[model samples]
Target: MRQTSIKRLYLMEVGSMPEYQIPVVCYLVQTRDGKNILIDTGLPETIPQEEADFENGQDVIQQLSRIGLTPDNIDTVISTHYDIDHAGRHGAFTRAKYVVQQVHHEDALSGNPRYAALRAEWDQPMERIQLVQGDMELFPGLQLLETSGHVPGHQSVLLELPETGKVLLTVDAVPFAEGFTRDAPLNDHNPDPEQARKSTLKLLDLVEHGQVNLVIFGHERAQWDGLKKLPEFYG
Candidate 1:
């Protein structure tokens, strides 16, 4: 049998904060076995600029159109967490089963105010979600790294591409490469700083051990600017 590989990996940029100097990004992975997996959902189109620093054209649906895809085409929607910008369009993909950490799903449904704004978008019917716990392989080369520090039950992803090698996406666990190198400094941003630090260290160890060839930060502007965006691909 032929081995499965990531055929194409599109780094989708749905929105950005010019003033804050960061870009809100998501990813689309097309596998050799015919799978369309989306990482984050970005912001919803209906969200106003005054409410959030995002442009209307930067919607995920619009971005998908650029690559001849729609929400219905997506096979799976992996929600790293239910932050407004990351899960704002979850309700749109009716055909795709949403994947999330079991703990995050429970906490999100508990009416946490931080994720309250986009509750309607991500609080899907229980049947629509595939809740997984701890570390697990989503597929042959794709692994979900449970890094619950940035938020409760937050997770990251590791993709082992045939040509591109191992790519670790630290999501918000380490929002910047500098933060990862500096050992994930404790901050008011993290609800659980110690947990966050442990998660960060775990990722750093992977990098130090030469297991990861690329590290993508959640909202790192400098790194996002240098990445291969939609229409272009890593694999």
Candidate 2:
């Protein structure tokens, strides 16, 4: 559970005209125990063909390769929730075991149209799949915090990096920094608004305690005002 390093890979950009980069980043963490863990996989390559505007697909794979790692290099993948953009490309990591919230898995398998895209990509013969009920530690320093709101069983990862301190990876739990700290009800993708608010408050508590310095959003760029980049390790 000792800290190591975190890497960000840009997957896509969302918006128009003066568009903002809607990055579908995956955090690669090297633990003190020598484990290469991936937080999330960006959109699949077929996604662009399904929806021309979205730019992800193979780029995520390419990004990983550029850093001298391939999908196979990933040993574990923690999906924050079941969403097309977040979990669509999970199939790429065929050899890596996937850890997801059980509630979210059921919701995705319920055949609901809202999760149709998610099902399409995840409905495969996955050899290694671990379904978690709630918050649990994947390793010594990395823990999964259930923040169900954006989606049922939605979760966030808490990394107790030896060098970087604590970092909360809010995958859609708080899509932006403002949403991470404020009581805003505008970012819930799920049908439950109250749950969304509760999740926001839960994350705000962590921020208040200074347990988290880096809050990584699911689709937005990482906050850089006080954080360092690759080749730079914070302690």
Candidate 3:
């Protein structure tokens, strides 16, 4: 298998309400084979007005288009969980194959409100989805690691960078850098706090063992201290 570099794009910044600036970042992992795999899609453009109070004035898709990439260019999409803010704009990547954990699919289909909201995003595009059971290799150097806890099927992607070593694309499993360092219990958004903790510990082990050099969060600020932009690659 060949190695690849990961690039991130700041699609939108949300949660500037009541005094906070939380970014809704979308990652674009370009493979050695030149396929543009999108990690997540930000909030939909037509979010309900009632929900507008928490929204930041930014158009995620438009931002992507400005960088010369459109929804049609995406080939595969991996959703870390079923949160509205994370997976809201899934419809934009209509041409890509949707990937999610099988456990998450069952939970979401069970009518749980949290997962129910995600239905509108994936339900209509069932034909394009590929429900994975556990850890599996998606491409040459890209592997999906099951990191449940934040959500039933919350998972992270591992990319083997030739020069940079390993990089973990951690989603909500650890929302921010502090969460990874402190191993603190996240907010109530996570259904299984204990499981989340376990997942965090597992990540710590990966870091401690030098298996992964960088950990990128779904909603965090920086990708790392130093890394190339989404369109550029290292090694």
By lDDT, who's the top model here? 1
Arrange candidates by TM-score, highest first: which order? 1, 3, 2
Instruction: Determine which window of 10 residues in candidate 2 has minimal summed lDDT.
Output: 9-18
Error of 2 at 158 (Å): 0.6
Task: Point out the higher-scoring one by TM-score: 1 or 2.
Answer: 1
Q: Write the per-residue lDDT of candidate 2 for residues 59-98, one digit (tens) a residue.
A: 5566566557788888888887766667767778888888
Cα lDDT computed for each candidate against the true fold: 0.86, 0.67, 0.70
TM-score, candidate number 2: 0.82
After superposition, which runs of candidate 3 have C-alpha atoms over 4 Å from their true positions? 1-18, 49-53, 182-189, 222-235
Best by TM-score: 1
Estimate the lDDT of model 3.
0.70
Better of 2 and 3 by TM-score: 3
Model 3 Cα lDDT, one tens digit per residue, 1-235: 3534443322234332324445665566666566778777766566656556446445456655756878898888888777766787787788999898999877888887775655678674578989998888887667787899888888888777676667777777887777886447555667787888888888788778856776777555554324454335444
For each of the candidates, the C-alpha root-mean-square deviation to the true structure, in angstroms, is: 2.1, 3.8, 3.3
What is the model-wide C-alpha lDDT for candidate 1?
A: 0.86
How many backbone clashes does every candidate have?
Answer: 0, 6, 1
